[model samples]
Target chain A: MDSLTSPVKSAHPEGTAYGTVLDADVALRFSTLDAEYEAIRERAALLDLSGERIIEITGDAASAFAQRVLARDVEYLTAERCMTSLVLAEDGTAVDQVVVWGRETGLLLESSVGGGTRLLEHLKANADAGVEITDRTAEFALFGLEGPYAWGVVGRLIDGELAALPFESVVDTQWDGVDIVFARTGVTGEYGYKVLVPAESAEQLWTKAMEQAVPAGQEAVELAMLEVRQPVMRHEAGEGVDVLEMGAGWLVDITKEEFIGRDAVMAAFEAAAERRTVGFSGGDTVPAAGTPVTVDGEQIGEVVHAVHSIGLGSALGLLRLPPDLAAAGLKLTVGDTEVTTLTSPYVTPKSWSTPII
Target chain B: MTLEDLRAAAALRQQTCAQIKKMIVSRLDLPIEPAWITDDQPLFGRGLELDSLDVLELYVAIEAEFGVALYDSDMSVFGSVSRLADHVNPALAPSA
Candidate 1:
């Protein structure tokens, strides 16, 4: 690959009306897919994910305590694979979502930002169960890798072939001889990975990945892939849905074990999910995630993910709607803008999923 | 108005010390007596383990109580109960 093949910059940038990405707090932190691509293809880009919370569970009974508390089976999780689970309130409302990783001695729970303190208190309350809970977020650095060049760069430092690594699995591997946990799961829904390394090693990993990717000519994967991965979840591959929409349903074996939210999912299952997750493509401008999904000016549900797709030259979104309103060709209003409903797997991977050559 | 006057005005918004205490306590859901929280003591730091959520709720409560929206620049007012009273004092009535 040469500089011509891998452009130095993606078409989008921040603070522009054409293609912008804002986070939950309404901060224009991420630019459009083009900006992300330029960052990936040419130089090093950094994203402040300090928003991710971490929980540490130690003590003699940590494993047993987790097996009983989480919605997923922790007993089957080995040192190599990580499991995602939800800690539910008594009413089964999702209080916090956690990614549990097993170490040789104990378990680490990477929790979401909103409920970090509450989840820590809950974990500590299982006192007699002998769980020593602590928050270690300040102690580590979280970074992500995307773009076609990501594998070549990370694989050089790490021992494993990240390309062959299955998604949603956690491997405790060494990068440049430093022990790091590279998770296959990513928010961008691309062939990417997240690495949690010691704070001291962060700069080293960042510098190394940059040196490799720029020369390889692969740019950062586009935000468009985020929408594409949603439909890929339903493609009839290994229990495909991502956790955003009831993918946890396929994770927890109701018959094999008892877990939190089992009863809630079963109860909701018989009645059908009140809302179904769907894909939408609309005007050139994309709405924020929390924007209401509506049709005929009637509010229906909320948007989860939305982004400007350079591939389709329009806005795309992963939205949730009531079963009756989720049919293809059904029109809906995303905020003040109108969007047309589309089939699942909304964008084919050929052009949208990868950089258009 | 003087800081004391604003403190008094903010206090006037509270029907009773018990009511304010209950509002704070219920949000924390901690096992503490209403009498334990005096009007002057810090509602954070060593005395109260008020986490970030509690801090947000406190902002909302202050807004609702004083009818004033807290801005990012107003963070200094949230440093302590005393500071909050000082900030609200100019617009508040006495504790009577």
Candidate 2:
């Protein structure tokens, strides 16, 4: 793998490849900017996202009603695929982040941490009275494989051709002869898939994905196989951010006949969006997470996540900036350290963190 | 003043059993029960997991129902149905 521009490599490459430990036996690692996995933005790569929580919404009114409540158009999604969306409270604050999938009689909703309980409660209150809501977070394990080669590699794991499957497509099929529910959706900027397998069969599915991608003309998709905690970034960046500032305003459907947070989010959108979530340069010193962002001596927002990007020379951060100052080349202060603002997603898609083989 | 006078005085400032319990069930989203709740059970104990947020919501419901503003010290006064009943009785009573 090679690149014209790449972030500085971590001193301890091996330690960098593997992230902090989740458990004694399960070590996590993240790919660096020069690794082949980063190429996912352009071509393909794989990611493992087993830690994300999944919630299920079933019964008749699940689809139409959820479509009305969520930020994306859920009615248009079919069983074979998925879409990204946010669920906001009436105040426009992000109460829970969710992904909705249409699978047969119901929809599968993968929620953020603590969101499972909230989503379940929300459905119980808002969904049709007869709708059956279940928190299946305990029943299944989830894994993600992303990148351009994501489809090609994942297809090899299942019994049939996977690339032929439509985006957001889901099928109950055998992977290495194990029953699994494979959905074509992902969080990374590339085409990806999320596989839901019984907890008992998780090991088998994971082992199979690790072994199959290379043979399928795709490399193994190591999700956080390294120590890059992206969620931590989002969380640190999330405080100053309301939906409108996160570029997730699409989640707010003001025109919906009626839904939670519709008025609040729309009101916030109209009311100058006090702050905007933007990417910032770490410059010479990386601001600690939650460090306030300032411009011209006035406080704007704060840093959510700051990591030394091996792809970019300086520190890369997800920050919330006041709407007026979130443009490219805008200067801001991260703590006592002064910094410059860059375009959204300060890092390159796909190739930003990983190398293009 | 006599004990009856004390009870009367407390009653004048307290909330009704129906209003308090209704607010609890509605805020907690628990099944409605007309049975009277004695305020002795711990709000954070076994039967409920009322966190700081739940307690705050309960306060909002209490204020709305009884039309009384609760002070910070009043937060400790609510626990079991009995304590809640004792605390709200004076507020629910008709103003002299």
Candidate 3:
């Protein structure tokens, strides 16, 4: 399993910063974090999502297999729709978060950045009769446009009418006469869209899109995602961490009677939750994962992850605390500095207020 | 603050969140259990898939249930269960 690299990496700016996230080497910053972050928060950002692998599941039993594997029910997912779901291990641990794209043939699971190898392995190990999983990464390239004004970019680059399509809407459309799969999906609580174009024309599409929007790197994208509390699976999912503890229960549809990890998830849900995840912000120094969260010098939890939040102008991160202490507006200590447990969406997304015109 | 004090404060916020989640599920006629909704999950478009109509229902339900009039508040109040909890119970919101 070689590490994945962006197909458009050659076209990135000269000073781009690249880093490894799981199995992919991604652009951490194209110019500066501030510039790219501004693009995603204020204007539109062009994202080269080549780090994510696209795996197509097709065959006689594709539907049933997808229903059994995904934490969410996709039984009725038509080719006109797409959705996000968690691929959970049998014990309720998260293998990877994926975007399930409904296609005419079957379904495509777009793995979280750098998470494709593990997700591919998991699907194959569980492969049953009537299922054929194929790695289609070499055939197509995926790119994303996201921001409060990302819809405007869609209007400029593709179709003006497609800008206002319903969220999670999917359409097999065209770009510069090149057939592509377009979807109205977003990660940062913004008006986002994705285009799946042929590998040969990906660089050309990326170049054309770069004209309408700024090329944002992984750092900016992930930061905006954090501000909205979108689960960054690579950062949040840890060993012995269940969906409940990771605060990702919403990704799993517990009512679904049967699925991998259902029993373990149900047991955790039925019994008392030992610990729950909550958001916190404080201090100038970003605390490291495993940093002690204390009250009156008594440790009660640890930092799951943290980073200097450009939006908040301070450290922003998640804390895994006792269920009783997981709520917001509490004064606690994170690695010797007092931090405030705040509500979800530490920063409000502009897309909520902005509309496609 | 002491651990006991923190626990008491967290309990207050958690109680408020539980109430909000229950209200949302009941008013929206959502099929899943109220407890299934996490405190941090988004309430619009993506996570819960609540639309503008759902928001209107929640506004009325919230006014009647929690006695908080959020008609003028921005949509961010409905960003998450915990976020709505802060508005319904301002004591849980960080002091400005």
Tens-place lDDT digits, model 2, residues A315-345: 7766765444443344467888767544323
Candidate 1 lands at a TM-score of 0.57
Interface DockQ per candidate: 0.01, 0.01, 0.85
lDDT of 3 by residue, A1-357 (tens): 999988888888899999999999999999999999999999999998989999999999999999999999999999999999999999999999999999999999999999999999999999989999999987898999999999999999999999999999999989999999999998988789999999999989899999999999999999899999999999999898999899899899887889999999988989998999999999999999999998877889999988889889999999999998888888889987999988889999898888789
Off by over 4 Å in 3: none
Estimate, for each residue in A18-120, the C-alpha lDDT of model 1 and write its tens digit.
2111111111234444665454433333333334556777788888778766866688787777766666544444556677877777788875533456567
Task: Give RMSD (Å) of candidate 3 vs. truth.
Answer: 1.0
- Ranking of predictions according to TM-score: 3, 2, 1
TM-score, candidate number 2:
0.61
Q: Which lDDT value does model 2 have at A316?
A: 70
Among all windows of 10 consecutive residues in model 1 chain A, the one with the lowest summed lDDT is: A1-10
What DockQ does candidate 1 have relative to the true complex?
Answer: 0.01
- Stretches off by above 4 angstroms in model 1 are A1-33, A37-49, A113-115, A125-128, A160-163, A166-171, A213-226, A229-253, A287-307, A333-338, A347-357, B1-96
lDDT of each: 0.52, 0.53, 0.92
